[model samples]
Target: MSDPNTADCDSNLHASYYADGMQQVETELVENEQIAQSTYRLRVAAPTIAARAVPGQFVMIRLAGVNAPLIGRALAIYDIVNNDQGDPTWVDLVYLQKGAFTTPCSQSPVGTPVSLWGPLGNGFDPRPCDRLIMAVGGIGQTPMLLLGREANGAQAFGRPNGWAKDVELIYGARNEGLLAGVDDFRQAGFDVQLCTDDGSAGQQALVPAILEQRLQEIGDTASVRVVTCGPEIMMEKVAECCQKHHVDCQVSMETPMACGIGICFSCVAKVKQADGNWDYKRTCVEGPIFDAGKIDWS
Candidate 1:
């Protein structure tokens, strides 16, 4: 078993790295458009953040000088937009418009002053793999687009790009209208397979079932990596699927956070240690992304 003290030290070091790499910025919205049912894509002109951000990282956002919603909301970096010269200029965030913060954010017009900070948390490993399977549910598909583009050689993120020969996305939502950004994934060269609970779109099935079928089709699990986000239960099932297949899996936890930074312990998740014991790890710092096997789904 791993030493719990050693793990704490590592987590502290990781938190320091996050602190050093992040900066707060007061920017303005470039675009905020409704993409799907109750889903909206907000684009912000955060050049510094956009240039530094990689796939799977997220930002904390709030209306500038807003006192009503005291804390910022954490949103994943959906996709980074660039200028004609290929210079990163803005970042896009996709959000479900049900929450208190989101409801207001959706109504905010373009050019609204926004405050945010990030490029925070460890992102998915950009290492090349033979096949990459993205298992996502609900709005979890937000972070997969950029990763897919990087994996397919269409875009480069933090490191050198294009290692996977095949990239597929198995995404599930409550219904067809809620499957946001379907075309975006398709355009990024991902073989997109979609499912819905209500049978409103694609197959009337769950994401994990489709993932299992795809894993069976792939045969060899060695060079495969599965990354998942969205509802915790869904992620747990996806992790279970990966474990059963003996394939590597990474999970983006959706723990609630009062502070997007590591200060608050509100977003801590129980994580297994090398020693076989479990300890709390801050989702905003140590994760938001972690090994599937290490997470204590119980």
Candidate 2:
């Protein structure tokens, strides 16, 4: 009963939109340092991916010339740096060593060659707003860092003033030891607030609770936008808080993806449509970043 034209439009909108300069390239490992327990900060010389990458997009990585894993693992593009000529030259990946693939990846030598393809998936669209608040938990810090980097660039999101005022980061982790990259965020000029469940860090509370308190303090909820990435329950609670406060919010979902491209539907999330129906969306293409209110958390 759908209009053919409308259906075609929807298909095109949801289809994989590849940016220019996307390609499979052999990236040399520039730095692979253990930042925390079972966590690593990996840097690669991937000019192509870095040049096109935006906040919330991801890259697929695999050992060069190895087929044992068969499929590459998708990782969020953590950060990007440009050279003196303003050409992107480096990309960073901050990941937890949890699985077989990542464990081996953590031990990869600095000079090892790896296959990478990216800047894939839709990224966060930071609209012109008065304030931006990012709430993250544990390894969810990945995409948030890139967002911070963009905000620090001053001209990011085509905004003139940049994210100058009322930009805050509410980061929650299990403990102090697990709080990675706090210094980096602080150095980027964000009003960083740290939370820990064990009371071993800054504030003793969960991220959502902190976010709710911060929103209340802000008072002008209409002028604020909350962007979050973390545990599903935590994000769900964040969505609830945003809804109650009448604030706009976006979420970067974490889902297992076999192929970073849209060819595989392995990474799917239930999204609510305007027609009041729920449909499965490929997180690798249609998202990783989506309007928090549009997701059916149940």
List the candidates' TM-scores in order: 0.94, 0.91
Error of 2 at 21 (Å): 5.0
Off by over 4 Å in 2: 1-21, 155-164
Candidate 1 ranges beyond 4 A from true positions: 1-17
lDDT by residue (1-298, candidate 2, tens digit) is 1234433213524543443345788877889999876889899988877767778888998888888766888888877877899877888989889986788889999988888898787788756567788999988888877686565563253233355255789999999988888888887878899999999998999999999999999898887888999899999998899999998899998889988777768988888877777778888777888899888999
Write one digit per residue (lDDT tens) for candidate 1, span 169-274.
9999999999999999988889999999999999999999899999999898999999999898999999999999999999998888877778877988888876
- Which candidate gets the maximum lDDT versus the true structure? 1
TM-score of 2: 0.91
Clashes of 1: 4
Clashing pairs in 2: none
